[model samples]
Target: MSIFKQIKGFVFDLDGVITDTARLHTKAWHEIADQVGTPWSHELADKLRGIGREESLDIILRAGGKQDAYTDAEKTQLATAKNEHYQRLISTLTPQDILPGIPEFLHDLHEHEYLMSIASASRNAPAVLERLGLTQYFPKIVDPNCLHTGKPNPEIFIKGAAILGLEPRQCIGVEDAAAGVQAIDAAGEISVGIGDKDVLRGATIVFPTTSTLTLANISGRLKEAA
Candidate 1:
């Protein structure tokens, strides 16, 4: 049995899961950090990964020790600057940015009659999907921009399952970030962590990368566990 055999729905995180846009996001953050007169260290950029745009901005600003340095009005100004930079960066995305076997993985899921959806913390998730020509694969999307609460809270994943008309137990949430994996667990859903294994510490199932995973293989794992 493959994990896919038991999963009625597949919930995915956009950036590092289906695409390699995490590096692009990090680059955008670094660019904006420089403009904000803040240093952009790799460690700081890593912390912002897999979170909402507003949340990322908050992290960056706070790390810069400018949380209270700017008024709400000024904070909005900074946010606008960051968005502009990120938007510009998004234009650089090509089909090549999509990870290996990702499109195939999605297609396989669809063929298996698994409902697919995107549940990302990024407000830019919709646009990212559009840019990657992957908008059609995901009929339902739940982004922080569409929710009051973000990841690491589980609301987003819960809402995503709701939109897909599935129970949390029927869906497998795929994520590449620690916060995202945590969110899935909090939602009472099975989580399959992709990419770095360290970040998926508590994840019940972990894969090094989507390229090496197959629906059949995952289904086998699920059956073995059962």
Candidate 2:
């Protein structure tokens, strides 16, 4: 069935969709898990994708069979530490760190004057965009810290559309994580997935990677949906 929308704006996820901070996140989480004696596994890593700070820490604790071992205060401290670590790792980011085809895609969108906003779960969305010199392309970014719920809840995506002065039916939400895609779908926006098809089956359309995410490809998909 067709699920296309008017698509007046684009709602973006920062980490995996704009750049490669996903690895930095994983590394930081891994360090935290090691310190907390969490049994690190691929399954555990997969669960962390698109997860928020507290939820990610909770998952780590659960994997270590230490979910009840830490008090809420202790968990807060751990989450803070992980954020610091991730920040240090992302400090190396520059405009050069932007993922493949991102510049061209953003250029086309900007030239077309399509409104754009960031709907990422990361509190570092602003900093990352500034670092990559992409802040000019996005005038609005939903504050993760202000959100009562993260991805898979659609709150962030909904906020993104609102900031762009558009309804959910007038925007396309692009994401690289299943949880993020689910949020976009739930928000009633067209969802563009940038990863494995099976993992992102919930997306309206799935691309293998950002390298293949050219504006032409996106337009083709949108036309087909129309």
Candidate 3:
């Protein structure tokens, strides 16, 4: 199977797919939960997956039973603080963090002239891509910082497909969160889920991990689904 024969374009999500930032996010969430004296578990963290930092904080706050409503400024402050912590932790990111087969997988898509873009909830996604020398891989980046809403809304994925000059079904979305999968489905696009199996429920196809994805593999899977 050839990717050139199977898909028109590719739309990728940033955090858990292109970069190993999910672990950093999880670590930061644990720290926040500890400091706020709220219990944080994998279950709760999974619940926060694929949403913006502000939204994640709001979810955490509600789970902790905090009824006092914070102003937008207060919420922004918490998200900013978490980002500062995450940035410090991610400063050591290298090409190795690009996942086992992802760089080659991207190259294969590029060689096949598959249009590429990113639809990510992280405001810092572009910076991460720039740091990893992947800015050239994605010309259209639909990030939370540039959008009014994030995943499960379909706005980012829809925008990314538009920028790629491809129809939603002609393009495939690579995501690692439940919200992202739902977002792609809501957008009427084909989505490939790329992390824990449970995160892939609504995705058209689920790859256990990035380590197992190659363009050839993707093409085969896409055909199987079709």
TM-score for each model: 0.92, 0.96, 0.91
lDDT per prediction? 0.82, 0.90, 0.82
Q: Write the per-residue lDDT of candidate 2 for residues 22-104, one digit (tens) a residue.
A: 99999999999999998788888889888899999988888889999999999999999999999888888999999999999
What TM-score does structure 2 among the candidates reach?
0.96
lDDT of 2 at 37: 97
Cα displacement (angstroms), candidate 3, residue 33, comes to: 2.0
The superposed Cα distance between candidate 2 and the true structure at residue 20, in angstroms, equals 0.7
lDDT of 1: 0.82
Point out the higher-scoring one by lDDT: 1 or 2. 2
lDDT of 3 at 210: 88
Better of 2 and 3 by TM-score: 2
Q: Please give the lDDT score at residue 182 for candidate 2.
A: 94
On lDDT, who's better, 2 or 3? Answer: 2
Write the residue-wise lDDT of candidate 1 on 1-226 in tens digits. Answer: 4444556898888888888778877877787677667778878977987877777878988888867776888777867877788788888777787889888888888887889888987778788888888888898997566687777889999988989999998898889999999999999888888877776887768889888767876766666656
How does residue 39 of candidate 2 score in lDDT? 76
Candidate 3 displacement at residue 17 in angstroms: 0.8
- Among these predictions, the greatest lDDT belongs to 2
